[model samples]
Target: MAEFTSQGGILRGQDVVSILFPVAVIPLLFLLRSVFFYVKARSQFPGPPIRNFWVGNLDQTMANDVHEKWLQWNREYGPIFQTWNSPFSRVIYIGDPHIITEITTLNWPKSSAQYAGFRPLSGDALFVQTNHEKWRIQSKRLAPAFQPHVIQAQRPCLAKHLSNFVRAMDVVAEQNTVVDLSSLHILLTLDFVGDIAFGTNLHAISQGRDCRILQLFEIILPELMKCGLFPLRGRFPILQKTRLMYRAIAELRSMAEKAIKDARQKGDEALGTSPRKKISDILATQREPDESYTFSSKELCDNYIAFLVAGGDPTAHTMSFLIYQVLCHPLVLKKVRAEIDANIPFDTTVPSISQVNLPYLNMVIKETLRYSSPGFGTFRVCPVDTTIAGVTLPANTTLALWNPAVHRDPKLWDNADEFDPERWQSGQPKVRGSYFPFSSGPRSCIGQGLAMLEMTMTLATVFRRYDLSLESGFQMEYLPSFTLKPKNGLLVRAILRKF
Candidate 1:
């Protein structure tokens, strides 16, 4: 009996050891991993102290002015510094123009972990595509649609939409009422993109209402920002906000699918008679010329939605900021107006792209893009252990080109904080990678040409016929989102210019 009791006690002891051993060993293994990551990140470069082993610098990133925070950090810690998204995620921010050039010119793949937020909306579209070969083929397929000639051919569509915008503003000017230029710019761009890209008459400008597509984007963009900040939110749609976001994404995808179907049925009629094919035509193609890869129906629909969103929001926000900046500085405003007056006629006839010769206005646009670019940074990832700007980065390390920091770096630009358009006019050559508002490299913004044309035309059209002033007691406040958006909206009063 004594022997049996001893044996039973030993068995119980073994059971306890079996249970407690894993609990203790598992935590020990996790600790080792955390330590390994922390050491690796610290050894790579100088950075802000990691306050928490788990959340590491994520608290600072949650602040409303995170971009400004990044700038401050860039100043404190040299040009390249490390920050953590989580214990498992280390982000290296590059502010040095030379380093930026190296990374971008090499054409490193974008980080899939960083770009996961965009996948929910853009799918495998070029904006978030990480696979090199797939992205290469897809970009090649879509390239013709945004060629210079193709964009120039769409000038008439742009002019028509701008005309509608001006007519709407004329009514507001006659009544002497405050107009939300932010909202108007968004509507105008949407109309232009809808007509030119998809042959869909959103009528946002003429009808003076938000289309269902725009409304859906209004829901999706903010959620994208949230998902970017908290990646877990994207993996699990348990929260009400996340659930709503998924629903909106579904609806937008459905709308895009329907539009694709309609375009397919209508054939070439859908893309009007422009010799240059529109984005819709390119996306609706059944197969590539070589027939090696055929775009799935879902890819067609997602790319369609991607173009719609990309073509509208950033351009609209940029135009709004451009107008605001010009108006705020009277000297700048005077020069821009003088240049516009000299180049464009005072009458309502919209000037053609070739007819306008406003170098000063172009400078102002460049300055605005430098000063208040809609996107704060561009992200990339190294596929193999690589050396950039003298630092050896481990394979799969996330890299962010901090555009705002680079653009406003005192070392890069003289009087970096000041809103001076003439800086661009200096005969001295610009530093490579110094002012990439649309980013740099092969993956840079595909629609930059169209965006520039839109800005030039809109600025010339508006300033030629009207003088604008900020609303009484107006103060500019930026909203934190996927892009830098004006809080509430920009309120301004317009007075028709007399010839």
Candidate 2:
């Protein structure tokens, strides 16, 4: 008989060995895990002990606002910290300008897995694209679309849209309704992007909840973000093949392809039906030029779909949140409106893009961008073993720099918490990497110019004719991911100015 039951079979010596072996091995495995985590962590720069394998801060990460949490960590820890992703993965959050600049130096094909997150949906649009020669070739080919004269032509259309927007606002004001301006702004921006992409308005501006376009947007964006945040599932490609994620992706792809096919057919009809009068000339320009770049009809479809997703939502969220910040400071709102009226009259039928350079309006936009950046920070995995800012990091370490934290660094900007635009103008040390509302360097937003113009112009038109105010019951919350947007919506009240 044995002190412990050995139903299978156990020799006299084997019973003792079997029981002792597990007891010895279990602690050893734990010791090894702890030792590895500790050695790798300490070998780098020092940081808070909060990052532990057992606690798994991803919960804390998902729970608290990363923007606030990052700010808190910077206050507690220094500018640089070494953290862990899981049992054996690494994550770094860099706040120093020099470190960030080195990482964003445009390694081209050597760029990070960020491209992978968007590639499934976007394929290879300029945003979320890292196809070395493909992007360069396509970018050069597409650059003609944004030339001075070509971009100038769109001004007429944008101005016309802005007038329609003003009229819409007038109606909303008359109703004395509490408007979630964020949702409204998102719809308006969606309309603008869809119009430019397909040469007609999608009429998303007044559409209610669960519209096809909005539904498709929610499907793609949240999943794409989920894929990025928790990519363990993606490290194994077979997991993506499972029905769990595949169906979600299929829905987004179906909608994207349908939109693309629709746009292509419309372009074809325009070219075939009226060669001399191309409806949206942007479509006509998609054809290959001397093989500098040639896009398949499918590629054209994907590109427009990509632009719609990338360009529309971020700008809408930014514009909406900008107004929210403006609401917080009625004095700032009044100042911005005064600048708009002085420069471009409230009833102005149309104004040149150059006219949006009104001082306070520009200040407000700059402040808005700083106060609430649209897109959150992105990640990079080292191509090979590398040390950054005294952190000896190995390849495959995911490095992320939280811009929201960097933007609010008191060491970098004055009254970091306060909504002050003067800091940008008043000899503000030109803080490096301090304010990358749009991610900086070569990979910075290619559509920054267009988005900047759209937001500034639209806001100019609205503030000039409207006395902006938030309703008593207004509230806002942010859901951070690829871009930052209000969770429920941005509710506000507005009235027409005496002007």
Candidate 3:
């Protein structure tokens, strides 16, 4: 009996060892791998000291002032430096315009690690798609909808929405109320994009409130930032607010599905009859004789969401920043208003795309894109070992084209920190990689033409009618999210201009 009991005890001890051994060994291996990479990265490039071995500099990278931090690091460690997102993930930031030009010109693959967060919202859409062939096909098919002519045709539609927006503000001005300008920009852009992309009047501007879809986006974007920087959060439910994200995603997809159904029904009635095609019409229509390129119902929904994700927020944020900058600098505001008054009629006449030609206005737009870039940066990866600017990076290494740093680099600009529209007054060719707010290369933003038109017309219409002043005692702060936005929203008093 005693011998039998001893044998059972020995077996239980062996079972415990079998389970614990791999657990101990796996972490040890991970630690060694992290150490090896750390040593290798340190030898090759200069970077800030590692604050934590486990999370690395991820906390700082995710902070609200991350752009400023990158600028500081650029000054201290040179234009090119390395940082670890986590113990296992390595990132290299390139702020040197020459190096950035070289990398973008080559058209290297986008970094999956950086864009994985978008997959939850965008799926295999062009913005988040990593496959070159798939991206090419998608880009080709969608290019027509954003052609200059096509976007120009939508000018009337844009102007209609802007008229509603201005009227909404006119009421605010009459009340002598301080309003959150950022929220108003969000509503205006949402309504315009909703009309163009989904063929539905969200009435976000006319109704003077955000729709359910917009509210869902607000929830989804922050979660995307979390998943984007820390990829594991995307894969594992426990690591993120999966329930909230999934619910929002489900609702958005459901809305997209309904839009697709409506578009299909409308197309059946107007088959080969309509000349002008909305974005939804283009997305929903099947590719004749080339069924392979035709989007599945799911793909249609995903791409629909992609258009919403890309179109609305970034442009709105850019406008908000432009307003903030103009308001802060009274001289810039005077110059912009004077230019507007001199060229555009003071009546409620929204100018056509070709007619809205204010040189100083264009300069202000350029300077705003540079000084307060809405996009944080773009990411890329090399398929093989590559050397850029004297540093050799291994295969699949994530590289960031740090736009904020590049735009503010002293080597690239004069008085880089100042908001000077005059910097562009010379009309000289820009330093190639120094001012890519829409990014560069084949993967650049396709909707940039539309965004520019919207901005020009909106600015002209708004400043022509109203003189805006920043709320007293209001200081600007940025929100910590995928894009740079005002933390507390842009508060201003809109005073109706007297002719």
Which lDDT tens digits does candidate 1 get at residues 4-86? 23554544556667779999999999999988876866787888887887788888776677768777888888788888777
Off by over 4 Å in 2: 1-38, 42-55, 106-115, 131-134, 233-249, 262-285, 289-293, 387-393, 473-475
| Local accuracy of candidate 2 as per-residue lDDT tens digits, 298-368 | 56656666667767888998888888888888788778767777788655655677778877777777887
lDDT of each: 0.80, 0.67, 0.82
Clashes of 1: 0
* CA shift of 240, model 1, Å: 2.2
For candidate 3, write residues 1-499 as lDDT tens digits.
Answer: 1222355464465666777999999999998997887687666778878888877887787777877888899989988888877766878888888778888787788999878867877788877888889889888878877887888888878988888888889989999999998988988888888878877788887565447877888878877877787777777868446558867988888888888888877877887887755767776775658544367777777777877777788888989999999988999999998988888776765766765788898999999989988887778899898877776777888888879888888888999999999999785667888888988989888888888888999888888888888999988787757687788989999998888
Order the candidates by lDDT, highest first — what do you get?
3, 1, 2
lDDT of 2 at 19: 80
TM-scores for all predictions: 0.91, 0.82, 0.91
